[model samples]
Target: MKSLMPYLKARTVEELWEYHTKLMQSYGFDRLIYAYTCFQSAQSLTNPEDALILTNYPSEYIEAYIGHGLFRDAPMMKWASRNVGAISWRYMWDDPDNTPLGATRRELMALNKRFGITCGYTISFPMAIKRSAAGIGLVARAGMTQNDVDALWEDKGEELEIINQVAHLAITQLPATGQSRILTPRQSEVLELVADGKSVRDIALLLGRKVATVDKHLRGARESLGVETTAQAVRKASVLNQIFIVDPGTQLS
Candidate 1:
């Protein structure tokens, strides 16, 4: 088991991702899809900014998966959503009661087979906060069977779990660059003060602006984030890593 501490401490998201991918490949899992969501709900499953997805799968396969709405029915995704810890796809098929996949989901699984995404383990990490979840799907290299992959996991599953947990934590700390809409400096400042529980009047006083101007900025932030309330705007902005960032000599009270 490689020590992921150095990678976990990486200063940049790209560096962390690169090292993590290399570590997975060293374990014979050459393809990986890692996703995390701070807001997971029945209605918002398709909300683009709520979830962050990183993958090394082929572009065509990814296009088809998203284009056909296959993620909604992806068996491993379903398994990850409700459970924690690592489980092989074989386990899902063998123990349907615990990790059931309906007929359509089974078809989706088979469809993945055509793309050489047949055998792998799905690792769902324990969520530390409500409405939050993270998971990784480790796809075995071509020609590997379930038995072969299972054997590898049996030998290294515990270490893999530890590695992935750290990796997830590292990923969440990274700025979600381009994954969500960029808020203006004023919008970010307003949202940050709002998150600190400041009222519009307080924010106006703090920034030496009029109450109307403060209210306009807040409203603009809500609209830009496609959210209805200031609280929602603050949360969405935080999830997008668009707020609470310190710039030199920038003060917020």
Candidate 2:
């Protein structure tokens, strides 16, 4: 795998994608069939498999997986959804029941016929923000012996670690979308005045409430925005479009 140590510092998704592609290429397996699914409802599959990945795969392959519901049934997807680390199919054939060696494993044979994929390795990492898991699938043609798969995993474990790190970086880099946290009417009014630079005492007097009551509203606003400080609460409110901004100081009423 090409050195992704430098890309650990990359601030954008495109840079990370390029670094990952190069890493996969070094291993002679570059097609990354990555997908993200909610942990609570893997069956629901709100995000398309192709949507989460920065690198693109064959359109036919994408269509095939969705059309045939392959992601739902693939054992690797099941492994990835539950675990936080790397997994490969080198020993899957050793399973006594429904091993990949049998005719009942016709799904594997069908995949080989349709996609030119005979063997594959998998790595899955859980997403930090959402209760979901993200996985990267590396498939290759036959002749990759178990030793070869082990060697590749040993050689590329560091790269996979970096892949996980870069994924975390991308998640943090996402801009805060303009969505508002729901709040009570009084809470909204209290924060709105604070945004206009009004002090708590002044707000309390204007709203005909006790100072303690006004303070409670501000605290609730902070909790709602998931911030420690009032300024951060204000900024989050504005970012989520919960509160509209006024250049010249305006009242909530």
Candidate 3:
């Protein structure tokens, strides 16, 4: 599989998603879905019953899934929420005690029969430091043999793992409330350094600027971000995910 290290430096969120979608297609899978719970704040107790789903599934299939609330009934949810590995629906649906989703289950089966799809492989990961989870599911069609699964397993395991990590970062940095704000490259840089506990002098030295200049940059960051102190600027930036707070110097390509 191709390395996704370059996407870690992606200048925008759209670029990240584009890179991820391309990576999924490279795995020889017919369909891919990435889903995450929505959050309101760091301290939010419940997720407000909303999620983001990115997939290549046809519009009708998506409509059917949502119309039936399959996300709530999907057997994959049971394993994904608790188990970290891939799960097979055939095994999950076969377990009688589990109470399979009746309508949705039939729909999925019919989908397979109609579209020649057969197996599914799902990988789940924790999204944030808080209570959210993220998952990606790859669907294999009827003609796909063991060799196909093996090929993907061998070639794309690391790629999927890296995608999981990137998804986590994206979720952690996602805004929790209100209208979001955009940050200029310089403002993002200064706030990120501040959040990492860098002093003005050190930031200036590293950025090859005078201390006074760095302080001015910080002031601009504070105003543009609509915060008061440098600490607040840092905190807001972290909350808004305008930049990577942990390693401020890391630049997105």
Q: Residue by residue across 105-203, what tens digits does model 1's lDDT show?
A: 776777787898878999999987787778999999887898999998898988888888898887777666344336788999989998888999999
Alpha-carbon local distance difference test for all models: 0.80, 0.61, 0.62
10 residues in a row with least lDDT, candidate 1: 92-101
Q: Give the higher-TM-score candidate: 1 or 3.
A: 1
Report the C-alpha lDDT of model 3 over 148-189, residue by residue, as the tens digit.
675666766666666656654664454422333456777888
Off by over 4 Å in 2: 5-12, 42-51, 91-108, 127-130, 141-143, 171-253
If scored against the real structure, what TM-score would every candidate get?
0.85, 0.54, 0.57
Off by over 4 Å in 1: 42-46, 92-107, 177-181, 246-253
Give model 1's TM-score versus the native structure: 0.85
Worst 10 residues of 3 by lDDT: 40-49
C-alpha root-mean-square deviation, each candidate: 3.6, 10.7, 8.7
**Native-to-model Cα distance after best TM-score fit, residue 76 in candidate 3, in Å:** 1.4
